[model samples]
Target: MTLTDRLVRWRYRLVPDHVLGELLSKRWMDNAIPLIILVAVAAVFGSLIPGFYGPQSLSDLARQWGEFALIVLALTIVMAAGGIDLSVGSTFALGNIVALALIGVAGLPVWAVVVLTMACGAAVGLVNGLLVGYLRLRAFLTTLVTLIIVRAVVDMLLLRYAVAIAASFPDSDLWFWFGDGFVAGIPVSVVVAVAVALILHLVLSRTRPGWQVLAVGGSRRSAHNVGIPVRRVICMTYVVSGTLAAGAGVLFASRLGAAGSDIGLGLEIAALTAAVLGGNSLGGGRSSAAKAVIGSLIVMILVNGLVRLGVTSGANSLLLGLVLLIAVAIDVRWLKNRNKVLAKVYVSPTYADLPPAPGTDDGSPYALNDRLRPVEAIGLGEIDGPEDVILDEDDNIYVGNRTGDIVRFLAPDYSRHEVFAHVGGRPLGMALARDGALLVCIGGMGLYRIGQDRTVERLTDETNRSLFSIIDDSRLRLADDLDIAPDGRVFFSEATVRYEMHEWPVDCLESRGNGRIICYDPNSRTTRTVLRNLVFPNGICMTHDGQSFLFAETWACRVSRYWFDGPRKGQVEPIIPDLPGYPDNINRASDGTYWLALVGMRTPAFDLALRMPGFRRRMARRVAPDEWMFPNINTGCVLRFDETGRVIETFWDRKGDNHPMITSMREHKGHLYIGGISNNRIGRLKLEGADPGWTGWQSYWGRA
Candidate 1:
């Protein structure tokens, strides 16, 4: 390789361009924009306003911010349920007046006043809920009416009890503490607000009720069709919103001990501004407590900074209106185009200069031939994608299809077939365990097993995670192939940690090290990574020595050996560094050899594109996925190689009939069975000079 080529390869390898795509794919990325805005606003204010970050100023601001955040949280809940509560401001005023009247006029206990105040707010919310949720009224008009009615009631109550509340002096320690006390150098209101935020966050993210609320918000018709009580969930969201707003009012009243007509006027507009700015979706079903908090901080900081800068309240309101308009525009545009932007950046390509392809002309063992043409098709058009074929002790043929079923063809004739077991998530490579259970590597799921009782159980779906990796690689993404070791540990290959089974071709385009080999110990019930950073690790086969195994890196077009129990444990050595096609499943042959299936052949055009990562990146960006250049997987062949990596022979269907794209093959009882992920039948070829009685089950368990 030239110096320039080596530098380009190293640049792609070290920079980790894929991390940007991975981060963008995450759910938390939605908060990124708001979080950055919050920081920037705080920085600008801190720099401009003297003593803005001082302890005294911050303490005062924290108390006010906490109270405002409570109102925003209330709006967040109602909005998340696909409704809006414009009456929250009036509800806040009502709660404040009630709490004061109970304490001073009625001489009630502080706790009773708190409860009664919240109950009053809940009563108003119940009316709105009944009108909007049950009566199916328009949420916007319903809440707007509630706002006027609740404000009118608050005004009448204030006229009746305003003087008495102002005159009476309550000798309550709890009331005073609620107003002025501090806990751990933080205001009491801020502490309570933080606790409430935590509880609401958990409820929205971790509880069934929270899911129901989101479901109803996303689509009421779909939620009802799925048996969710959509109306009840919506009603409950309004009730929760009212209760939270009242709770915040109690804090405000305790701190200031004042209530008037202007106390909560236009509060809803400010709270709405915070909610949308914090990244909460106005349409619902896409909000979190973190977003409400971020929005609260931005609005409060902006408002307070402007106030300190001698900006008029009228100007402040105008600026807030402008901010809300801008926030709404950004929220709508970002939500609509987020996935489109991610699609453009997510398929990161990397440079891979593979060695020269070996010649497949006549005289070469890798030469094209019609050896597979005479093979007999067992099921023909009756079956679906049987990616891998295996056999049991009784000679019954077992193959996994795309419909998530392990089908069994009865022995002798191979004519009658039945659904052996239904293991979901597209079963890929399968193996016969020594204990007679059928172990399978389901593509999107983890390792699974179908026992003699026909019950399917999951083995392991996760492993130890990489410490510094940006993507969460703990969960198995594509468990492609597996093999059993002598000590009962199962070693499996995960094709790619970055993509799912349907996106396997994208992995080929990138040609990066996103695959790994994992070992699951049955005794300890633990799974760990045995090998890492392989390019599309596909097939795994334990060697005869019982201490080592050979694995095929499909996109790299090579086979390598790894020792797990010998003196060379944890060492990886290349066996076949070059191959003519993308190798797949490796199985033991009856003649002391191994059979490997090349799932697809490499083309000169594609090989040249691999060397030009920039060109591939542009193609992925400019073209649709179906139109992009993909590996030619429609044609492949099965080949036999000895222990020394020497190709003994190959089998191909030159006419492209019977078995054209072979993914796996197994030698059982003098017959070679061929399976392809894209074919509708299983192929059988009679071996003339082989062990007729050697069954894979017997080889592993010794004639149980």
Candidate 2:
């Protein structure tokens, strides 16, 4: 390749083709947000202060952050491993005492004392590791217990040696060098902090052990099943944790010129807050130590600068409290919180109605009808994330609940009735397989084919086996819906793994559309991507023509058609754009037509908000669940069209009587069966004399 070509390739490669866009659009990167904030702060201060640009203040600032930075680095690893260590402060004090005891009491050499202190730290970490890793103890509770015990032990040891250290006289220069020495204009402490960070980054990004640690943190069960030796990695994190805390202790002593009983007090929260603020997950396995270090530095700078600005100690405490709140807000629980962030902001609400199938639409070219209505209130009794729905040959209804399970209703009457499958993890879409079996696209768990006997079997789980062994999360995210070809080739969507179904808002807020259309061949028993790098591929529908299919790209609010055979083989083209609502499921109309369900209506506000990634992410991460600030597809509705890309008729569920968030509605046996991922009842209504042909086909071929 030429230089220019290579450069172009490199740029494209780094550009998160699909997932990266989703991540970037949502401001999902740990560094993305913090980096911006840091730059803004630095710019403001550097411009505001007369001597702010001077090297002296910068150097002092760098040096001043060593303690917190190192501590944060340790906490970053802990959080990344999916846990916390509230006992770090006690461990820090323990390290100082051990170093002092080794040098002054044991008369050990300087280098030996350093090694011994680190070993002592490892031993302390071992205890914590054993408790947390082997015993499977809650990290918070174990660390809390360890903190108290370790502090008590340190206090007792200090009282025993207080007089001896004082009388022994001049003490050791070794402790001072390890703590407060300078090397090439940078303090040894700062150098150590940087080195630790570099080492951590390498472990996290390049090493197998680091990968295991992350896997363990993110999902411990997943790491164990994948043969990652999770316990060993978890225990070792504590070892590293203790070592860093001890090292920080040495730095503390050198900085302070002496060790005391109250050494390294109350620093755990600072480290955790730093790690979280730096963009690491408290939910484990998603962390960056480097980001944590920078976060630590930011915290230190804020604290020091605030103090310098004559801020009261009380105000400083409040600032710390606020920083902690922000850090906590970055959690997965916070991210998945649907009630807080309105739908349209996190997940795009605007989806254009696909061109009507041949003869049913408004007789116009493909586009949303100008008559689209916006509603101020929906009368549907509490509905949640409606992913997809299914209907039986009898026209009985079934809705897949994103947060819960399936719901079914009686035919034509819309009387709520049953739940055929209670399988958990966001259930997206469902369809009746040819064999009289109900198949569901269970998000996180895989594509489940449930038999009439209610026997749930996972027919397709590994999507190309890309991360089979490294499946940190066992749930299947085979998104919104699926369509089976006549030959039983199941085409499904694998949406962004970066965000879970409930947490899909994060993906939207981050805008990293790492999505793909996967084809699962039943005969070959293989799942492969038909198209990769899509913006958040949602629903799938196969045409009775057997030549092409349609699917939704939710975040982009577009519906597209993909040709499976003939002249345009493997080609994809946009069928509709600028949808009025977030499109969910697409089903064939019984009367040689097609139906597209509108889950929510999109607004103009969302399009402009996409440009402001930071604001979007903040809204997702920090806003109230039901706050009107977030945009949502205004109301639930469905659209019908003939096969030739024409506008048919639009059927709306303005009262949510048919179901709010109309994820699915399949025409079967002269009745329209409506299902939703989060609807309380599947709805059924007759289309009067409509028959998609198969009247006697099911009985003739035995449920064909």
Best by TM-score: 1
Candidate 1 lDDT: 0.90
Candidate 2: tens digits of C-alpha lDDT, residues 1-704: 45754564355446433343334334335477777766776676667666764777866677657867877888778878888889888988887777666666777777887788878778888999999988999889999999999999899988987666555433666566655567887888889888888998899989988898889987888888878888888899988998888888767655564557757676786677777777788888777766887688667767777766789978877788788897687655555753344343434322112221222244433333322223222214433554555566665556655555665655655534566667776677776677767777777677777788877777877665445322222234646578777777888877765566566655555444467787778788776767766777878888766788888887666788999877989888777755656777787776666788776766657655654444554564466645524447446677886655564678664555335556666666765656555564445566656865443124212444
lDDT of 1 by residue, 510-616 (tens): 99999999999999999999889999999998888889999999999999999999898988888888898999999998777899999999899999899889899
Q: Best candidate per lDDT, number?
A: 1
CA lDDT of each prediction against the hidden true structure: 0.90, 0.68
- RMSD (Å) of each candidate, 1 decimal: 1.7, 12.5
Q: In model 2, where do residues sit more than 4 Å from their true spots?
A: 1-387, 394-396, 407-416, 461-478, 506-512, 607-630, 653-660, 692-704
Candidate 2 deviates by what RMSD?
Answer: 12.5
